[model samples]
Target: MRIATIGTGSIVDEFLQAVEQVETAECIAMYSRKLETAKELAEKYKIKSIYTSLDEMYQNPDIECIYIASPNSLHFDHAFQALSSGKHVICEKPFTSTVEEAEKLIALAKEKKLFLFDAISNIHLPNFKLIKENLALLGPIRFVQCNYSQYSRKYNQLLNGETPNVFNPAFSGGALLDINIYNLHFVTRLFGSPDDISYTANKHPNGIDTSGVLVMKYPNFISECVGSKDTQGMNFVLIQGENGYLHVKDGANGCRSVFIHTNDQEVNLNAQTSMNRLFYELAEFEGIVQREDYSSCYKLLEHTLEVVRETVKARTDAKIVFAADKR
Candidate 1:
């Protein structure tokens, strides 16, 4: 798939590097507000085309797909433009600031007959697939705990009175959307949406959550997800059941390995061959587009919509509002 990437963030750099590893995908163009920034990434990735304006980038006929890694609040606008211009979109996770934005983008993609992907890598990882295959071994699940906490350097900037986009409510930034969403994806993708959702957060002065615990109540199991940007914590996921339990190493963001324990057996499984988890999702997306598998794409898109709904509801439950909420 020929691609043009938006944004020059660190995540975009990772995406470009992962693209080099995928034989079916190549990033041929880049779009950034700054010419120097776009040129730097383009030169690094051997991309020949760079545009300062999104409209110019979207007009390029060589771009079969647009990979969007813009800020959280801008996801909706960036993706809407791409889909509207008849280009497939691989939007970075947290799909959009609100459920309404996600729904509108999905509707546009459907209307345009274009592929729309939520760039969530964990669900597409090989290790994640293995965990699903062995989830039945745990019998009846009782509880799940997922922790993905990293002390963000940007948090320090916030403390110093500088509002980085990650902690700024105006940009739809918070621990839930930035980090906890991975836990949401891991749980919801495996068990579907929850019966109830609530979030308790440590809010900054500006009403954005710096850290929080998200509780999802299922019919039989209770899933607790902890995500923090204010402090560091042990990062892993534990799934408990009546029979045994499954332990996921490196948390939901990276299901690096899985430890399965049953009554009579214990096994450690790691099916992922590459540390670049982004590669798996990009390759899968490329294949879906190549085969024109709209059915499967929409199936995954529905799952993305569910995650978005859960996220919006949970954050609302905590009374943590973003600038987008007013819109």
Candidate 2:
């Protein structure tokens, strides 16, 4: 498969390295708003070409897939363009500003018979899958908690009247959108959408949420998600049940190990380090593209849309609204 990636950032480089690990996919080009920046990465990766305009990139004859690592606000536009151009899309999360945009993209991808996957960084992790397999050992499910908080250098800049995409509301920026999104996906993949959601937010002086705690309630279990940009915390996941509890000290993504405590017995599981989640995600995407698995594509898209809806509700509870949602 011929692939193209859009963005000129450090994560984009990391994504390239991950994609490089996949054997079936070939990156055709890298696209950036700055032609020289895109060319630099293309040369570094031995890509066929580079283009400044997305229109040109979409028109490339050899391109069949696109990986969108652009700003949070640009995901809908870029993914929609790729789907319209008959290319599969691997979009970074949060997938869009609202559920409506996600649904529209899903419909478009269906109309074009293409794949549109939300490239959630956690779901593809080996340790996460192992955790799923080991859920039975923890007894009946009860309550769950996930916290992924990191102090951002950009938050300091935003406080000084220097607003960038990471902390600016115009670009749909906030700790909930940038960092907490991973926590949301982590639970959504395990338990699907919550029955209800509530949020406690720390609003920055600029009217953006710098940190927040999101609570999602289900029928039998409740979950707490903590995402932050203004402060750092112990990134961990704790799942408690009737018999015992499972502790994952390393958060949901790039997890290090899992420990289950039941009765007088304790079980420990350590995942291998070299198994990058992106490697598996890209390989699975390749298979979906080759097989025309519409059912699985639609199911994943529906799951992504559910997450978007829950996020909107959490933001609303915290009194956070992106400008586009008003329309």
Best by lDDT: 1
lDDT tens per residue, model 1, 1-327: 999999999999999989999998888999888889878788888999889889998998989999999889999999999988999999998899898899999999999999999999999999999999999989999999999999999999999999999999999999999999999999999999999999999999989999999999999999999999999999999999999999998899989989999996889999988989899999899889889999999999999999999999998899988888899
Off by over 4 Å in 1: none
Q: Rate the local accuracy (lDDT) of all candidates.
A: 0.94, 0.85
**RMSD per model, one decimal:** 0.9, 1.5
Question: Which residue ranges in model 2 land beyond 4 Å of their true spot?
Answer: 271-275
For model 1, what is the alpha-carbon lDDT of residue 85? 90
Task: Write model 2 residue lDDT over 211-262, tens digit each, in one string.
Answer: 9999999999999999988997899999988989988877876667888888
Q: Which 10-residue window of candidate 2 scores lowest in summed lDDT?
A: 271-280
lDDT of 1: 0.94
